[model samples]
Target: MRRMIFRRELKSNARGLVIWSLVLGGLVLMMMSVYPSFAEDAQTAEEMLNVFPEPLAKVFGMDTLNLGTYTGFYGVEVHLINTLVGSVYAALLAAGMLAKEENDHTAEFLLSKPVTRIEVTGQKLAAVLTNLFMLNAVIAAVSFACTGFADEAVELDILVWYLLATFLLHVTVASVSFLLSAVMRRTRSIVSLALGIVFLSYALHIMAGLSDRFDFLRHVSLFSFTDAAAIVENGGLDAPCAAVMVLVSLLCALGAIGYYHNKDITG
Candidate 1:
């Protein structure tokens, strides 16, 4: 039953995923056109680095330095933008994926199955993950192609680690959305709440960089740990910070499971 529900959900969503894949592909291509030049010479790399706001780097994982290599350029544009934006965008999409049906009362035929709600919710999340991974794979392919013309060898270890961290960030966002849907009554409210959390946290992260007054906001938003520059330089996870994110994500996932378990089937 869970499998049946998941298949239906994925089939329904296939078109949107295809559209998003194209949009992301375009973003990657646009970045590729300019990024290669940015790292083509020492002067270009230095200039590219300088254009980024110093404090803002902390919020986007810009602390890493690839030291004038393809990895460095990839980190600057592709990984960085996706780190800040992709994670949340994917989450918003996932959060309302299943819950929206319920909120709209379109889930009746599906939920009427003999399967338990947990199975349904869990399988739906799995489907979301599968879709998200496909998107990530598309993005990664473009990135690898862009970074292929390297003056220096590829840093596979570090690049993979950072991308993993970025993907985990998306998973966390999906969990948060799922948790929200379980409690929020209206789908409109759910969308606003999901997007609000992502955008608000992002705005706060930026504010934290610009003002000391909002400095404390750094601890709360996931974007604070997404510093692409830092990841590229280190080529791996920020152990302590990554752990904190995992814990928070676990809590959100658990909350969603618990809430759904007890939630009345009103939708």
Candidate 2:
């Protein structure tokens, strides 16, 4: 039954997965295509960036903007924006998965089946994770292809680490949103709540960048640990931070499973 439900979910969400992958890939290609032009005027670009207000510059990672290096350019230009888009897609997809059945008045029929709620939640969660992995895989391939076009030699290790950290961040956000789906009665409400959480985290991250007083907020925002500049500079993910993210994701998934096990299903 779990396999049956998992297969059904994969089939149902296939269109969305493809659409999101294409959208992300297209944006990455467009951004990377301009890398060569920036590389040509690296010094000029760095000087120009220096003129911007320090706070404003830091918000976009311009403080560390190094057009001279491909990784540096990508850290500033592509990573932040890509993270935002990918996180939103992940949150929305997870929030809608189980909640859609309720919002569309199909939950009654679904619950009428012989399958248990645990099976339903477990299978659906598995499907969400699978979709996220597939989405990241496509984006990673596109990013690498674009990088190859923009540079002669790429830092394969740093790129792989960045992708891995980004994937973990996505999974954390998706798990939280999935829990929200189980808790909220309406799909619209779940989406609004989930997006609000992502935006708040992003805003907190930017605010943390703007001043030292808000640096404490970084501990709360997943974006802080997944910062591209920091990731690329450090050469890999921070072990403690990555562990915390994984723990949070696990707790959220457990909460969702527990809640769904006892949730009332009505049309």
Candidate 3:
């Protein structure tokens, strides 16, 4: 049962991965254009770091861009921009994925198979994980080329840690989207809410970062965990934020499973 569902998910996501790879490759090429200018400036990496807004640059992973005497450009392009773009893309993709089947009335056929609901859910998750990894792999490859062009030996350790932060954020988004699928009656509603939530969370995080008065708002927004700068240089997920992600995802997964289990398949 698991095998069958997994295969179905893989087949569905294959095209998505391909399209994403092309887009990600193009973005990498574009960001890489900044490297020559960043490298040639007589300014030290620390000085370049001083120019961007503290809130803005931290959001873009400026803290980790400073690796060696000559290796900060990679952090700005790969860690900062990649985290922001990747989180939104992954959220949208996940939000539409499962709910579309229910929206199309195809869930009847898919669930009618001999497989149990648990196996079906597992397969869907497997497909989600595969898609997530493939997208990151695309970015990693293209970013490799960018790093190479910078004429500095890149630090693989920081890159991998930043990717891990990305992975956690991706899974958290997928779980929320899946829960919304379980809650909402229509695919259009799911997509709208998912995208809206992503942007809303981001705005709240930015606002919270700008003023200590708004810091309380940060706890309610998931974008707090999307801090690539802290993850890349600090080599750890922020403990409190990480806890929030884990708690939210686990609760959402449980809610989704229970919702679908009791849901009237015919309705």
Q: What is the C-alpha RMSD of each candidate to the true structure, in Å?
A: 2.6, 1.5, 3.0
Query: TM per model?
Result: 0.87, 0.95, 0.84
Best candidate (score: lDDT): 2
Q: Which residue ranges in model 2 land beyond 4 Å of their true spot? A: none
lDDT of 1 by residue, 3-74 (tens): 987897789778877887778767877876775555567675676667778776544444555536666656
Which parts of model 1 are misplaced by more than 4 Å?
A: 44-67, 211-215, 233-235
Write the number of the candidate with greater lDDT, choosing between 1 and 3.
Answer: 1
Sort order, TM-score high to low: 2, 1, 3
Worst 10 residues of 2 by lDDT: 147-156
Tens digits of per-residue lDDT for model 3 on 1-267? 649778877787788778876877778778776667666663675575678777666555564455332235555555555666777777777776667777788888988788776666666766777888888887777766666666656666766666666667777887898888776778788888987887788888778776668878767877667565555556666788888888888898788777777776652
The residue-level lDDT of candidate 2 at 130 comes to 97
The residue pairs in collision within model 3 are 60-80, 65-72
lDDT of 2 at 106: 86
- Candidate 1 matches the true fold with a TM-score of 0.87
Question: CA shift at 90, candidate 1, in angstroms?
Answer: 1.6
TM-score of 3: 0.84
